[model samples]
Target: MTKPGAVSSAQLSRRSLLRRSALFGGAALLGPAVLSACGDDDAGATAAAASGTKVSTVFSWVKNVEWAGFWVGDDQGYYTDEGIAPDWIGGGPNAPENVQVLEAGKAGIGLASDTLKIIDAAAQGADFVMFAATLQESPVGFAWLDPNIKSIHDLVGKTLGGDSSSPSMIDACFKVNGIANDYNFIQIGADPAPLANGQVDAILCYTTNQVSVLEAQGLTVFSATLTEFGVPLYADALIAKRSFLDANHEAVVRFLRATIKGHEKNIQDPELGARLATEKYGVDLALDYDGQLTENRKQIELWVSDVTRKKGVLWMDKDYIAGPVYEGIRAAGRTELPDVNKLVDLSFLTEAYDGKTTLLSA
Candidate 1:
């Protein structure tokens, strides 16, 4: 029987195109009418000025509840209020990497999925800086249909399905649980069909995403979140190239101000954010409204935490950033870590809120 949070590769692969379409569809959103007319010699400079200082942000993933705040900000004209025209670029398999997009001057800021990627980029001489983390904890986890598999320790000899990124998380789980590496890993995409069909014992995926898909399929799923398993990784950080930040500090601050406000609004009414994302910005992406709503609520749970409760959403303290967050990356086999001081600049977030902490509600 298909368990809750279990999906076949066929189901996920089919929906995968919907996500990719949003990435490619971003071009349609950035047509001439939206972008300001400019000469080739100073395209970036003129584009920034033409539309009241255009600021393009490339997301790490396609449009979904993960970007509910950006959609809410756009719909509510928060970006306009900040005196900037924001272009939100979606990411997918076919989309260029977030750092590459930023390096090419396509985006002023990018939403990166993990600190590892940022660290790697910095090591490779990319002048990128993480200004804020949207998700306090990562949603990466292992989802299993078998009741026997209640924890990461239970999957000693079971087949774990996931993509290239899955192994590091699995290794982290073993290390955290003080268990040996005995689990067999099968290369799989985001699809949980293999697991559902008994092809694989379990699948590694985002708890906020595949969990809802499996539950919708009426399966009983048990998920082991990596965060609880000894890998407390942060997800979805706001990043920008150093050059971009240096030239447009005010624009960055303004952009974050509107984005945080949007997140605040989304926290108040997730259904509204979901509706706006699916019916408006993601209208052409063929999104499932009910599913998106479920994901939106789950995503909010990841965004707010004890830290965010005290300092507001997207807040990160130096101790946590340099400690557990960095250690998680190291556990994943990354050795050349970026300097914490050079990697994160909290001044933008500080400036956005005027040094005052806004408590998260709900």
Candidate 2:
């Protein structure tokens, strides 16, 4: 998922259009490497025929614990074992949207914030299909430094700060608990400073990102995730164009296999993943090592759940896609929900693990 200040979808779409034009114009002058025709599949074939294929993946945000698997996989030569040289693209406020980049053929695979975005993009004829879910549950939640606001029920009469869209999830939670809406929703950015300074009782932010920052600033922050309150939404999924998946089936499988192995390694030893992300992949980001380590551990906890514990990391359970994920989208007022079959393709993940759930032993 994107950090607080990341650009919006509209902004990303415009930037991508410009980038596509520039790339196409440069292709005639620079040759095939600058052309979209040299997609991941062709790259893989070239790798087989020559050295190794280099594939690029556009992440949703800047390098941090959220991308531990990719970093660890690259560091451990997991992608190399698959005959794939990975180009890890860092994203932030200026990076184009993942789906836009994939559709433009700038990147082979991309990570999106949620399936809903992919569904919406597909409706607009993007042809993006999700292959693996990175985080089982979204980390979006309401956080506060006040100890009295322990649960969702306690925020009934308080003022909460967040984007206007955040109310959909909050409303879904209130509906599930049969509680009447009494709290005042104030529109704000993804900053917890207002809550820290007593401007708002709580603020909606990603638990994995902001909670640690709040705690480190000398506040006892308490949080309640949307999933805990009956919104079972998945976050951060790997997606590629349908045409790309159709052409590079084996390449996709190999990529996911290496990726899953990387996640397993992260689960087994989060410190290693943290070190790789901070000291290696994210060296230029000036990330805090201790803060990143804390977030990495929290992210690993989110990656596993009752479903993943048995079905393996990145497992796309049909029941989940059809049930809670669907309901959460509807609750959020998104009506153009794509068909579950069209939205996700789990064949690669299933083949990666041979249809067996694999979990790291504690």
Candidate 3:
């Protein structure tokens, strides 16, 4: 007898509607023509010539509600006003990874979320530095059905399913709680079938993503954000190569200024982005309006924090990174920890807001 809210194998296909594969470092490289700029070409070119430089921003995911701010920014002419004709290249499961795009000089800015990967690339002499983050804290976490699995510690002797990055994050979580790092982990991609049918106990997921999919399919899923599990990472991280930063510092600041305004717009009208993504930006993907709206609302909660209220939007705290973030990765068996200062630069965001928390007009 299946318990209430338990998902069966027959219901697995329901999740495919919102299933998004995690972006890896070695995905196929895509060309510039894949996704055009969200901004007007003629006007943006003129503005680029007058004040800002043209930049390419390679997104880490599909052009769904995840990129609502960028879409809003383009629609509002924020990028053109800042003199940037941004080519908003969208990424998907088969798209080029941000690291390769940036390293190959294909993009000036890239959205990367994995802190460990950024550090690893830096160790290999990639010369990348994170400037701003869309979400103040990571939304990635574990989703489970067992009522017994209340806290992260409860998964002590259970089989967990996740993508490629789950093991290190779990190791980090265990280390922080002073729990013995002992558990079974398997790469199960993004499906919740194994978990629903009892092949695995839990699966790593994003709060706004897979969890939402499960709930939409009549499954009541309990989840804990990555911060609660001791791995507090900044998601939707905006990164660029050091040389690009050196050459186009002001352009980068201008881009962030415009992007922050777009994010502010998203906060005011969550459904606006969902509509934009569904009707226009991601129209070909056949995204569900209601699902995107739910994801946007959930993401808004992750975007703001006490730090953002004081330091301004997209603020990256060095101390926070040095403490919990680095500790988590290092505890996960990583040997070298990159210097936080070298890995991040908050000055770009500082210049964008001029020491204020918002650019929205009152």
Candidate 4:
């Protein structure tokens, strides 16, 4: 007989949902014919334009919601106003990884999942520097079929899904709640469908994505949250090369500033956001545009609050990062943590909310 706490197959179902946003990046909404932009312009140039120099932004995997804010900025001419003319490129399995591109000078901004990667990158002698965090609450959660599997204790012996990036949070949630880490965790590369297929019991997911996509399929996913249980981590940071920051410091700052406003819009407007997401921004709408858009908007709501605003829109809690984050990652068996200060650059966020940019009403 199955234990009372153990989730049953009946609990997880074909018509279930999971948490939304997580590791997977977004895709562009519309193709070039459907949407158009001034491709080459020195819009983000802070000091001087290098005679028609064009910079490229490598967004992760087509278009996920992580890059929506920047897309909003571009669509609204925010980047043009900032003197930066950027061609936002789609990233995927074939696209260069952020660290590599930044190192090779391929892309200007590097977007990725989890701050843990930040420490690893810096330690590897990678030139990436974290600018701002996209996910305020790390976007880590488990999606099960059964509401009975609400608590961590309920996850025992149940099959979970995710990559190494989120296992710590998953394990932390289980550990803090007194659940065993011995539960089934299938190694899912990037797709959340396996969970929908009922191949695994539940899977780690992001609130702005998998859940929404699954739900859109008329499947009901029971999203289990790590923060609600016990553990927490940072997700989706806006990163850039150290040299890029140094060379185009003002531009980078402006980019961040514009992004905040863009995120603000990204949250407020879903259709326009989704339409723009498809047309300009590269968010993978693959049969789930509304779902993806809905989730992205939800993320904006969960995080973009005054609590995060330190005189402006900043996604960092200083004491928490300096204290909990460091200790937490170390406890997770990471070699070391990145300097909390280095991981967070509040200057741009400060300046934007503090009225630094005179152009876009920042």
Candidate 5:
């Protein structure tokens, strides 16, 4: 979500509203010839750029605590250690879509949040390739003030509020439970104040964002995540043009190596990570320090999994993609699926970890 100002009732509501209206629309692909977007011998030039291999990475949102790991990696000189130089481009409500930037050669790599939209682009023949997913589980959830609504099924007959994606999530949840759409869903523009004030039964929100804000206001918020409802979708995917990866495979691996180190640093000390964002990288954003710290702690919860614990952070599981990820997308509305093989390539992360779960090697 895009932040407006410091954490306050007005800021929180504004931020959530901006996030809801942020719908993804497809951008035209420029094709393999678009490699010119990086200039001649793109790979060679990137490797030889003044300080180190210059790699411009585009993100789906602003330079806030959401990307603390990357900021930490840059600040810690992790990229330099790997003979790489990173140029971070921030995206937000007014920015072009991540894929559009990649297509236009404005960025070599991108971090995107919409898995279904990525598949749609690939299905339409974009050269995008997802190398890793930062968030292994979807954080989309329904928060309610009622203690009686313990699970998803408990809200079958209740009124729900959410943004554009909320309906798909609800439909997917109901599809899995073999139940009909029995609830009244109004697009409340991602505001949970209605739920808190008893105007709506539930409102869809991210536990890391809106829920945290409500709870910080001393409201007892009970929620269930999409994964908990049997629909797991990936978020914050790291992607790049297939042509770029084909030419600079080694650079991609090194980039992941440094990035994983950054995440490890954040996981070990979240307070320091929060400071890195609010105090340095995102200083101009006027981000709330305590809010960012709380978000950092909550965001960490979505980055790890049993798969990641064994394979390392940002691990790509083919089985998981083919199963839950694909199923969740299908339930959401996309029936035609892109081949998972073309959509994801795990070679970069595989080489980055080198048969080890932890990159530092103790």
Candidate 6:
């Protein structure tokens, strides 16, 4: 019953950035509170800060606060502290992973949502695996508030938003509800203001993101979690090649160490990261990023509810990672399914959180 749609292709050009400093708005609530950990050496325990090892990583997108840890790690010199020099890579439209980059040993790890990338690479003579996931609540659901549209049954003829950014998780949820193909989606940009502004009845959205942004802006959204209604799909995983993991286990562990520190910082001082990210990811976000630091903080906190909050817990679920993922993607008619295991690897996170420090406690 799961069904997905083809994402229209686009180019990967860095767009012109519009800057809005929350501190400029004059509202204390909008301004990011100065946090104590900005440059604090909290990572002394986990990161060895060794030098001479070189690495490369490509980000899925730029300016999304989700990857703030990478920036903070680079800015805070966490990677340097670990003694590894990382050549942070960039991504844009049609990035297509360029598996050869990691395959030919040009890069050490690749970041993706699921093991699909890794699995596909394996199938194609490459190697990869997903480990830790950044976004907890996948946020793959419909964004609508029309009283007449309480459930999927009401979506038969309504105009749903669409775009390559549309999530396959929504398809899984809709299939579980036995409502696939019930409505039509109109493809648009990543920004879902059209749905919020009443341009359409609803928009497929990520709970951890777009809908949350809209709701915080005084717009209420009626949402359905991908797992809540039906299929289970993991989102935004920290992935690396299997061979790479076997070879760079220590470096991978350090990468997770730096990343865990960043996420914990995001959880503890969300405003600081969000504000810095607003200015950091200049082209991606539409709203004032600094103004939305509180929003980002709230969104990230809600992302890791009770279950995933336990110390040393990385939320590793193979069924969630491999199952409905390909089901929905194939159903949605995506060209091919990437290798599930290739898209994921947990050793990094396992080693990262296995330390004496707890992300929840930190």
Question: What ranking emerges by TM-score with the best candidate at the front?
Answer: 3, 1, 5, 2, 4, 6
Model 6 lDDT tens row, 26-59: 1110000000111221212122234636556655
lDDT of each: 0.68, 0.65, 0.71, 0.56, 0.70, 0.51
Output the number of the TM-score-best candidate: 3
Model 3 weakest 10-residue run by lDDT = 23-32
- Highest lDDT: give the candidate number: 3
Candidate 2: worst-modelled 10 consecutive residues by lDDT: 26-35
Candidate 3 lDDT by residue in tens digits, 54-77: 676777766778778887887778
What lDDT tens digits, residue by residue, belong to model 1 across residues 329-357? Answer: 66666678778888889998989888667
RMSD, every candidate, angstroms: 6.0, 9.8, 5.2, 6.9, 6.6, 9.5
Q: Provide the lDDT at 172 for model 3.
A: 75
TM-score of each: 0.83, 0.78, 0.85, 0.76, 0.81, 0.69
lDDT of 2 by residue, 12-55 (tens): 13233223222111001000011123233221122223244667
State how far residue 248 of model 6 sits from its true place (Å): 2.2
Off by over 4 Å in 5: 1-50, 182-191, 197-199, 330-334
Q: Which runs in model 4 stand beyond 4 Å of their true positions?
A: 1-53, 123-127, 164-169, 172-180, 280-289, 354-362
C-alpha RMSD (angstroms) for model 6 = 9.5
| Candidate 3 residue pairs in backbone clash | none
lDDT of 4: 0.56
Tell me the deviation in Å of residue 280 in model 6. Answer: 4.5
Shift of residue 310 alpha carbon in model 5, Å = 1.2
Q: Between prediction 1 and prediction 6, which has the larger TM-score?
A: 1
